[model samples]
Target: MSSNKLSAVLEKQIHHLCLKDFPCGYGTWRKTKDSTEGAETEDTDDLLDLLSCRHSPWRHDKSWSPQAPALRRLAVLTPERLHTDFIYNYFTTLRIVDKGVSVIDDGLLRFSKLEELVLSDNKITEIPAENLPSTLKILELRANRLSALNSLTNCLPPRLEYLSLGSNSLGSHDDIFHLTGRHWPQLVCLDLSDCEFKDQRALLSALSTLSCLRTLVLEGNPFTLAPSYPGFTVDSVPQLSCLDTSWISAEERQCFRGLAKNSDLIVDRASATVSVGRARGIPDPLMRVEENAPDFPVVNYGYFITYEFLSHQTVNLNFDRESKSDAANVIEDDADLQSNRNCEKESCKQLMVYTEETCHDVTHVSGHSTSKLTWSECMDFSHTHTYIVGDLGGLKRFFNKGLYLTIEEEKVLSWPAASEDVPLAKPSRPVKEKKSRKGEESPIKSGSTKDKSKDKKKKSVPELFQDAPIRRILGSVHIPLHSLVTGGQKVLVLCNVGALQTESEVEATQTLEKDLGKTIKEDKKKDKESKQGGGSSTKQKNTAASKGKVKGGQECKMDVHTDNSVSVQLEPVTVEFNVELEKWQSASEAHQLLLPQHNSLSKQPVLS
Candidate 1:
């Protein structure tokens, strides 16, 4: 209780308390105690100054609590050493307040329940994979220098759904697939857009196989091209159902429509005629023939007629004559005569004539044997010769009647008679003549010769029908059918008929028929083989049944039903031709005939 004694006790108690309170206090006091000489005074002064400042750090003496409340959130602006005791029980949410500040060794063990981690917009070239907590849900690593996605793979929490790895230097679609495949099963949304998926197949494959994926943003990546079909407007994304492309222009749409319109189906007879003309040597003079002869009838032939029957036919004949002698010398002189004879005897003889004046009553006959008519006179003979032998055959038969049985004309000059030479007479003696009286002496007076011999001769007769050009008339006919059935519907039949020109058209027709026949035969052989195989199978089944083997009733019935259904479905429909190409008609008429029926049928309303 005495002043001196109390002061000593207080000093001792203060020393002990200071030692226990701050460990650094003892070190500072010891350092002051150890100071020697002049340094002792300086150290004591620093100690006093620290004590004074500690007593009143603020203007008002406020008590500093020994225990601080646990920091729920702490933002550090500057790099400073944190005392272990200061942050051990405090901070839960720690955020870096300054960018480019590395908090590398900051003890983070206090914040054990940290949920959201965002280290975005920093100079974080790399983040340690193990630093991330499993409790984290949102990890934003956007706008960083993450050249590779491998860094985040192991650190990514299963519950971490929202990950923004955008604006990083991740290279390709494969990298995207590699990154996502690890976490995509649970990923509901993926943003690989603008990643530049230059390889469409890789992108498409990745997109297709992603099971949990729903929203994929793939705009601004090229691979979109025009649609497969013209006028097709629907946008497609392979298996997925969304596409975003630039709007098509009106001109492009119009072009598509024009293509579709022009592609509509058409059928016509002129097509067939053109085909025929090409096969034949017939120069498609018919192309111009229409313009030249506008009055010609136009006719359309339906599918039923063979193109062969639509051509002209001309007859050719060869005549062989036998002579008793070689007489080669006289052959040149007889060239024109032989030509005339051949014309009269061969082709002209085969002309068909119709005396009844009706097409149905037309008949044929020969010309040379019937009369001595020439080519030109044949036309006049019809007018002059009243019996009216219409053709060469009719004329021959008419003239061959008992009343006018004509024989072959015989040659008037024999070769021997023409060869006989007449000898010149011996020079005759000059005969003397006496003049009469002076007035009547004129006969011999001036330039008259005593002996005068004179001679001269000439003669001719015209022939008939000598100069007419040879004319070969060609004809053809076709029959039309009322109806034909195709695709289980009755349709009209059109066909071409009559004899065709035996030249090229006939050859082409023959070739077509032969090809068709070969095809039919091959088909028939195949059908027969199939039928035989079926019969064998049926017989085997019967034999097996007769042998008393157990069989499932319903299975056999099902097989039978299936076979019947297949047979019905596979049955080939037979097509028939009912219309034929008529005589060469104008293009307009052909068009009219072929298109009307098709147009009318197309216009009819369906019963359904």
Candidate 2:
């Protein structure tokens, strides 16, 4: 509508826009004024106008072709003039996100060859299908005002492979009906996360029609809170390789198979088994010899486990008492872990620790001298804890507060030898009689400094192994609860907890360093230009700046050194565990009598 003139905001953002690749062409062409843009797009065979060179308009019929005369002076115009301009037809990809676009106007239809379009984070309420390019293969409209697909689904490109409609208000059952194979037959990956879609049955029934859908994300939907959710979703769409963010495992697929058809078999309080398996590539901390050791050294190292889980507490009331005479004596328990307390403050964030006393010792190949541990034996630590979840909402909360597991390398210096002849002086009097006499004779002197010193020594003497061995925190691994919640069965879940590292984190630090380096250079340039009045002050400032830089570099080096020496150097150890939810019958005898239906569920097909 503005002809060839673009708005001020569009002009500023125009340089960031990119041109799509030609069919069977070399590569994509970027429209940047920088020299690198030409180098980057030089391999392409098609001619591109990076300077927005205007050309005469060509006819849309048989006169326009790839080898048209007007193509020699191709006009790289703004996206708003896409309808009037003929040169933009060469582009196959268009991205106009966060542009405050409220409507899908006729401007986009001009790019007849556009294969991909990203219009996310806009105020688009409805998409007129006629305005879309038929060649579009991927369209991302996430975080938009789209409420329904009735208008858009009618003329959607047949070859559309990927569609992302997340963070929208498409909640109705009719909206789901439009998302079928009949509309987008070739649709492979569909993202419908963070929507208002309710009714698990209706959603699954509608999505089941998309036979080609390989990856489907239905996270943050209202139906996701149902106990039979992911189980039902998985069974409904068996063709999916991924759901939410997790990939479907063979065992998980088998567990939740045929669950959609059987709705009554959904679990309330599910059971799980957690097992800590053997670790590989664990370094022997005692390999480096220390001073003043016994002839034979005793090395002690083991695995420690810690995790946060949800546990339900119930209260019972007495009806015979005068205060509660009106209340009923009989009480019933529900599988749903419903609580009237505030979820923000009381969401069960309890930490459980399996200490050294409970852990089994790791076998050394050649005792303390061994550099590596044997792989055949189990390091020995496993636990099974049951969660009392009423619905998928509780499970979701548990997932948000992920399972925090830390793998610590505990080491002991030495164990005292039995042959060591440590002499102990015999007491002059009976210990109990002496204590009774002292208490009687020195009642007034009980608060004396001498008695206090003696008491302090006595207290400190019993604290064994205080300085014996050093405990180093190797690293921690966060285990996601998605598998636990979505597994949908009371089975032994084996989880491999790998040793954590910092290599993946270096990229962030590197980018930060680059940004800081640019700012430092600019600051130095400004300082040089401003300090023309004095030599002493400038010299002092230079010295101070140099010292600061040196100090910062040293600090950075120390941090990197510590990280490399501790977490990065340690090889990844495989810690396996199984977590199973306990049965409600085992929890209480009264619950067993009340949950008679649970016994019959095993005979039938269970979903959750």
Candidate 3:
């Protein structure tokens, strides 16, 4: 321990140790107390000394690997931070991972011999180019909130070859140009993976300029999510030696090049590649479009992905509420309403929102789908089938809670994978009695005890991929849609159409509910008469009457009327799909090198 430079304080209280003695391949990875205590180091001020004598990136060539000067490695990953800066010119490699760091002290500028610096898993926002030692060759800044690349202009060291800016908020279209290799002519690898990049064309355009780049990572972006992604990426960027985590295959290159020639042919966007496989029990790191986001579930039928959710309890669109009158106040001018509508769209110009047209191509990786339907807040029940109307009872219960609660969230929506032609297996739908109430009262029986128990046990899910985009789109866009029904079909409706509960809606909801109740009562009368008079003969006539009642959203010319707090009377459109994993993928071995391997002495963290 003394030969390894343990500080006097650490030599005293350190109960657990993971030391990488010099001239060794790997170090100990142990904790004394057990898993509950976690793999955490305390008061890391003494950690700097432990790393001072360790040489990282042990090379085949005595003097070097392109990673760093084949010697003098140091990593101080103590989350308990104390000193702001320290001068250590003798060390060639340094890592300060997850040390609650916010600022890089000027002391690092004095590390004239430093070749690599890792400040990942910190709360840093910007990396001032001025203070970085010009002799440094690599930098890792993952999991930060960095947005500006202009700060790095002309600040990169001349020999810098590897850089990682993954999991940051560099989503704006303008940041593409900042990635060029003009500053570091010797640049070889770049990791922009999981950054919020939606436009592939712009990203590819900027990447092509890096003539020296051999490796590129663009995973977790929406653009690369399509089926033709791998092939197209290999086709467009001929210089890439590696795309994402995999090497550019010669067969994949030939395949996509031929497909690129024909424009009229629909590019079959399926089954091109898969995500890195996850090792069991070793949880994959969480990646998000933005930190702490949420998502709505999109169930993909055989060919359609259905995104279903309900509206706010009180939709305050206030669209048609110019007057609150029994006094017969004339409605506002059409021009005034139109102008206000235009203002709504304009005011949301700055937020990062997804447009319908843009999101249309956003494929849910679970399965291939061609169409989707969205639901809105307000819906009229009079037009729907008797069965769909009954489904609204659950919606009423949900809306009454004044929160987002729906049928889709009852179980874990895991997509393991299945054939494209074969639909994903779904839980069996309980067969309900063939009962109808003329589109008035509830039709569905409460589900099985097992299902309700399972639902109750399912804990709140943590942040996932869909949550990232969902939160982004929901943040910038106003209004809501899609609520619960007996079957798994989603209802599509318009958001802006919901206005304050007007006299029309109040009167309409009341009249519709009464009319529906009468229909149920009348149906019973007909059934009784048919059973008594001519059971078999009148059965066909009764069935016809039930089927022909009414259907709306453009067909029956039925009035649209749903009160703010009334039971739901919405339509259900079925979009069938099978659950499939977007093919779970783990980070590449090369990606693991993005930071210093503190415990691996033989294999120091280095660009491969």
| lDDT top scorer | 2
TM-score of 2: 0.39
- Summarize candidate 2's per-residue lDDT along 219-332 as a digit string, tens digits: 776456544556667777888999988998877776666566554444333223334445554444433333444433344454454444544322123223574424312111
Model 3 Cα lDDT, one tens digit per residue, 1-608? 11211122112211112223322113233222443455553333333443343553322221212222222222234222212232244456666565556666564576677888777777777777877888888888888778877777647788888898987877667678777667657888988865666555566667777888889887655444433455556656778889776898776665556433322221222111111111111111121112222222322111112122221111122223563222121111112335533432222121112233221111111111122222222212111111101112233232223222111111122233434543433322211111112244322224566765665444212222222221011111121221211111233322221212223344566776677767667767877877777766578887676556533222323443324343233222211112121211222321232123222332433211
Listed in order, each prediction's TM-score against the native is: 0.23, 0.39, 0.37
Candidate closer to the true structure by TM-score (higher is better), 1 or 2? 2
Global lDDT of model 3: 0.42
Clashes of 2: 17
Per-residue C-alpha lDDT of model 1 across residues 1-608, encoded as one tens digit per residue = 21122123223322332322222223323344456654423343453444336563311211211111111111111112334344433322323322442332223333345454555554455545555655555555655556665555655556655455544555466465654445544544444432333444444445455555444444322221111121221111222222222344545444433222221222111110111110111111112222233211221111110121111112212212343122111101112434633442232222222122221222332222122221110111111111111232222222223111111211111111121233222111111111112243432223323332221112111111222232222222332211110001112222222222322233344565565556556555655565577787766665555333223333444444553443234222111222211221222333454355446555654221
Candidate 1 lDDT: 0.31
**What lDDT does each candidate get?**
0.31, 0.53, 0.42
Preferred candidate (lDDT higher): 1 or 2 = 2
CA shift of 565, model 3, Å:
38
